[model samples]
Target: MGDVFKALADPTRRAILDELQERNGQTLFEVCTRLISRHGLTSSRQAVSQHLDVLEAAGLVRTRREGRYKFHDLDTSPLRAITDRWQLPTD
Candidate 1:
């Protein structure tokens, strides 16, 4: 839970998760290029690496290597856990 909050604390990280939701199991370059260009926020590859690390630690995302490239995917179960615990008001 702490990791989830930590991963979401940064806007960039949240944006990364959003991208993963749209297209799961994408290579690192694909994910980074989409987010960086879409948000008009330039980030170094190293910066993207940091975001992935946090997200993985939070259990909100997962990554696996396929030959040369690493593919990342969203692990929405943890997010569902967090959201389920929240008390959102219904209109």
Candidate 2:
């Protein structure tokens, strides 16, 4: 859970998650492009790639390789865990 908090602490990381939620299975290039065009982020490809690495380490993002191309997908299980941990009694 520490990793999740750490990853979520960054605005850039949060934006990356939003992008993945809006459109799953995006390559590094696509992620960077959308961040620029949609969010007005000026981060470079390497910066975005580092952000993705942190997200993946936190279990909020998953990756797949197809031939030479790599794709990124969002995983919401960590978030579900957070909600489940704090859910109130339903009675």
Candidate 3:
């Protein structure tokens, strides 16, 4: 989907997804921390939150709130559409 591609287009967003892939179900704070420590991304919490918003809109990231904490998880099923759309024959 266009949204998926657009979401994956950004380096920062891709890094965020990579972080989630490495450790799914991370809080916003955790994601921010890892992005800085692991990926050396200096984005602020507000900016990273906005990137999460884009990923969420594209169905690449899912968010759920429990009590006072919100967790983010990666969803790669949407990527299947790309493979399916251009799948090669095995004949």
Assess every candidate by TM-score.
0.84, 0.90, 0.91
Query: For residues 1-91, could you state the per-residue lDDT of candidate 1 as single tens digits?
Result: 3478778899988898889989899887887798778986687888988888889988888888889878999987887766689956787
Q: Encode model 3's per-residue lDDT on 56-77: one tens digit a residue.
A: 9989999999899999999998
- State the local distance difference test value for candidate 1: 0.84
lDDT by residue (1-91, candidate 2, tens digit) is 3489889999989999999999999999999999999899999899999999999988999999999999999998988776788997798
Which parts of model 3 are misplaced by more than 4 Å? 88-91
| Full candidate order by TM-score, most accurate first | 3, 2, 1
| Predicted structure 2, TM vs. truth | 0.90
Of the candidates numbered 1 and 3, which has the greater lDDT value? 3
RMSD of each: 2.0, 2.0, 1.8
Clashing pairs in model 1? none
When 1 and 2 are scored with lDDT, the better candidate is 2
